[model samples]
Target chain A: MTHKRVLSLTLNGKNRQDLVPDNMLLVEYLREVTGNTGTKQGCDGGECGACTVLIDGEPHLSCITLAATVEGRKIETIESLAVNGRMSALQRAFHEKLGTQCGYCTPGMIMASEALLRTEKKPSKDTIRTALGGNICRCTGYVKIIEAVETAAEEVAS
Target chain B: MTEVLPEFRVVRPATAQEAAAAHRDNEGARYLAGGTDLIPNVRRGIGDPDLLIDLGGIADLKKIEVGANGARIGAGVTLAHLAKNAQIAAAYPAVITAAKSIAGPGHRAAGTVGGNVCLDTRCVFYNQSQWWRESNNFCLKYKGDTCHVAPKSTYCHAAYSGDLAPVLLVMGAQVEVTGPEGSRTIALPDLYGEDGQNYLALKRGEFVTAVLLPKDVLPTVYEKMRVRGAIDFPLAGVAVALRRDGDKIGDLKVAVTGTNSRPFIVEGIEELVGGPLSDEVLDKIGDLVQKQVSPMRTTLVAPFGRRRIAAALARRQASALFAG
Candidate 1:
């Protein structure tokens, strides 16, 4: 009884089209249909934003966002952070600062931090803290994550 | 909760009237706004809608218009958008504050202001997996007779957890509801119902289109108590808007949430309006609120403690408005 619709979207700067079920979540579309598994799903619930993605340059919980709703919008996932096969500044910062102990939360943390830096050139620790509040990192304490964001900001600015 | 939604037809409507028409036509149809709350509820098997009326394409419902009088926030405006709006921040700081106080940044990016205003009244017993709820026959909220919170009571005790509801109520906001019949504007207070089983007082095939705030400027403060600094529902929340007359309060409004089935404005605020609102006066109001609202055991952080927190929130917000 469900409906199947063609979803045309800008994924990681590339225009793509696919037939998706009306009930498919944005996260499921990214992982199952498109085969982009960098976006993890820790808690399918809105909490523990493991599935955070950029919809129109803003961080959103893909687990709750409907794939059909974002048909024509731009979606930037964790995989999009790398440029020409080189790690993005935020990803490199996370690597150097030891931002991930288990690496499960790294994708979401990077995407969230990327969204923050994309908008604000120099975000304070409190601002960074607020920006990353949605995504959870149980493996590494946030000290390294905060430092990585700070470092990435300097690199992006320079 | 189930991850996959049950089979349902998707209707992409471009206008509010067409969306309302879809609602009117389909037997079991639901308006899909932000879908942050509705999707999860559907996953939990709450409402089995045969047709999903997708309202995302309606351009008219995605605007935030700031006029000379006040602001008109569309039902489809996301909390993140409203929170970051410079005009809304300057004019309706309380609304911004309420928007920011919701779940988290990512959730806020997807959750709508109207969704929060029409947020489901929550209860521990009712909001669980079927197996979890079925462990004991489901509660009074759905498919069960006994009120889990108060076994002898006849009604559900789910608390209204929306942070925006109280803030909008205190600001004297009006809501525009669209339906198959027509569109009508009503005070924010009239939009709600007292019963937890059916929280929103909407006519069949009706949905909220926009929220209209009052024009008059007033100093407003919103205070919330929660277990965590963020991503947690308020145990007790208070919104206070003060109309000042040269240091003395000319008019005052208080709305309390997370303490009852429906968020409501405190009555008899006029008694405290005509004079300078002192700490003593604030404390008296707090005590009265504490006495009046006894939080039930739905979301369980000791009822008396939540009551006390509600009172304290009101006192603190009132004092802040007075100081400002």
Candidate 2:
């Protein structure tokens, strides 16, 4: 028997609906059905934050969340963080500060940092580290990522 | 045998009753909440259920409310949600502290308290991949009768590693589980048995719906010991509840986790209620707790390291209790 369920979700800024299997993870649905493959999946388990996305502007692991569970909720992926072909100040700082190398952890890292910045415009270094704790970057050793967030805070404040 | 991973149908029910009915209908089916624990087991093929009933959509389980009676924490409330909740932070700071230390923020957001409390007692042998288990000839925790950790023993030696269990035990929390039969409240302490494999005493097909924490017990603190700061399960954790009458200790409850198959309430601490909480008295209590816990080399760290931390956690929790 097919166990398909209807999910109504707001992805980025667009409202979308799809019928998917009951067990389909949100990350898979975004990659397969919605054709948004930018959100990478490192560890299907919640350990690596490669699947991190913003649920109601808060950082959440998309890989662990069920597609059906996000019904009627707003979700923001890395694709939405930028505005109209212009990188957000955070994105600019990430590039300038060399926040990424292999780029696998970029989406999740950007989403987590964006979530943190939304609430705290000028967060401390510790707050930025805690926000990005779930995201694992094997390259660059997170020095640049942390600096990028710090620079982003200053850029936004200025 | 072919390496094809078994696939299953997933059912999402809107209500608890509907979920229970689904559970009753499906053979070899398990209820899925956060999937922080279940998915990993499924990935390892240790959990081969024919059906997975996703309860994340169930309305009743997502609630977090406090009334005149007490706080009713819904089973689906994520650890991150509980950790950040203002009321929970104020009323039971120990629980918040415990929840915060459970995993990193993303896991905390995805991992529910219900999943954490109902976490399957784990042994290193049982938690390993099927291929790994085959190499070692299996263990008592899985299908085999031989306990790899303690070969002569009849039971499994999986450690109870949940960060929330000890805190809830010390706070005198009760779990309300809804099953095919009906609903029942098991005292947090009674919910877990010492046997690692068959750790939970809750009836078959029963799912924990809510946890009831009683009001106005005493000031409490949860101390968890781990190698790293976050994500790692407690090597050893302690929850201490203390009440002081004037200068003398009125009551004390010490609960220990991660060192045994189930969390244990340290007995004989009641005797220390009337005495002062001196360094000597705390040390004596620590010794008593050290005697009660029997840690194993089942999880991330060594057994001796776990045992040593159990006593240290007890002392730290006791100090926190007495300080406030």
Best by DockQ: 1
For candidate 1, the chain B TM-score comes to 0.96
Runs with alpha carbons beyond 4 Å of true place in candidate 2: A1-6, B1-5
Worst lDDT run of 10 residues, candidate 1 chain B, spans: B1-10
What interface RMSD do all candidates show, one decimal each?
1.4, 4.2
| Local lDDT at B220 for model 1 | 86
Residue A133 Cα positional deviation in candidate 2, in Å, after optimal superposition: 2.0
Find the candidate with the highest TM-score and give its number.
1
lDDT tens digits, residue span A1-158, model 1 = 56899999999999999999988889999999999999998778777878899999999888888798898999999998788999988999999988878988888888999899988999999999999988888874689999999999999899
| Residue pairs with clashing backbones, model 1 | none
Model 1 TM-score, 2 decimals: 0.97
Tell me how far the alpha carbon of residue B227 in candidate 1 is from the true structure, in angstroms, after superposition: 1.4
DockQ of each: 0.75, 0.44
Per-model TM-score on C-alpha atoms: 0.97, 0.94
Write one digit per residue (lDDT tens) for candidate 2, span B1-324. 112234677777888888888988888999888887777677666778888888878888988997777799999998878888998887888888888888777787778988999888777788767788878888888768799889989888898888888888888899999998889898998899989988999777899999999876578888887776666677888888888877788889999888899988888888888988898998898889888999887876778787778888888877776777
Task: For candidate 1, please provide the TM-score of chain A on its own.
Answer: 0.97
